[model samples]
Target: MNAPPQEEATSAARVLVAEDDDAMRAMLVRTLRRAGYTVVEVEDGFELGDYVAMMRGHGGTLAPPDVIVSDVRMPGLNGLEALGRLRAQGVACPVLLLSAFADEETHAEALRLGARQLLDKPVDLDVLKAAVRDAVARG
Candidate 1:
């Protein structure tokens, strides 16, 4: 069988978003989409893992996302833990972790786990966009 067409295989720089708050998730999806990225939205870290697994299960046939944006305090595995797991599994996409609680330990751990940026809650859209742009550029 022939491989899918390149245009069909890839869209604009892809971004995976895992935010537990419905409103926040919607806003992020809208903003990222408006910014010309293909956005995949999930409710929590577990769902984010599932999405990653689905992509990986296709072997290297699928194009992994350029960046991930996740909430720090979500159900199941938190953003940092999830990012660590993905890294362990050889997923190199940069992650931007968002949190309302800005604990030093969490920040340190997130950095250790390879999060590109940790933005506090009520994140400025411009800052968030800039961070995502930087992450994608880094990759």
Candidate 2:
């Protein structure tokens, strides 16, 4: 695959996406790929762990991705809790939270845990793409 464009590549990035719904996940992959990013797609927190492990295995001194986009709710593990765990473990990738709608407490917890963006459901694809792009850039 070609390297991501200068304007779109994260400062120290590779984008990771975590969403459970297959259709939504596929749409996200297609959208991000079409936008010139090489996105690492995962279905849930376990898969996220696997991906992160693989990255750490090969990501070397650079560590893992510069940014992550995650769905808020899922079975087995919820995004907020998993990300909090990741933070505790020092993953440090800036995260963007996506959900249909979350309680204020969930929102506050995400921000408190260092989420870079929190988006409601029925997302605007253009905005989602832009948020990912910008978040990656910032990272």
Candidate 3:
């Protein structure tokens, strides 16, 4: 037997969304919230970095979000840069990076930095939802 959709929604997996575009961020937040994820939105890489730092509890008591969905290109730190910093600090949470114009090198770096997935822009909502679910389940 499987849990009902309503019951699953109550699982409330936390998702951090980092995107510089206001419209895209809003859309991603709406999609994740509707899918029953507790979504946190950050406008740029700096905000993402700050949130991770604040959640990086002393003695490793605090845990990061279940997954992070970030845009690869942003002012200041960028998603790859943010992911690198987080990995350096031992944040092992799954990350899904989005890009409108990523080259092969960018893809290689994302993989090297331990991102779970690299999604292209104009992301399919269904794919995004599935990726988040997979990330949470894998964790």
**Candidate 2 backbone collisions, by pair:** 100-121
Instruction: Order the numbered candidates by TM-score, best leading.
Output: 3, 1, 2
Best by TM-score: 3
User: What is each predicted model's overall lDDT from 0 to 1?
Assistant: 0.84, 0.78, 0.87
Ranked by lDDT from best down, the candidates are 3, 1, 2
Q: How would you encode candidate 3's per-residue C-alpha lDDT over 1-139 as one tens digit per residue?
A: 7755644644668899999999999999999999888988999988876777677642344468889999999987899988988888888889999999988999999999999999998899999998988888776
The best candidate by lDDT is 3
Winner on TM-score (2 vs 3): 3
TM-score attained by model 1: 0.86
What TM-score number comes out for model 3? 0.88
- Of models 1 and 2, which has the larger lDDT? 1
Q: Return the lDDT, model 3, position 3.
A: 50
Q: Which regions of candidate 1 deviate over 4 angstroms? A: 1-11, 57-62
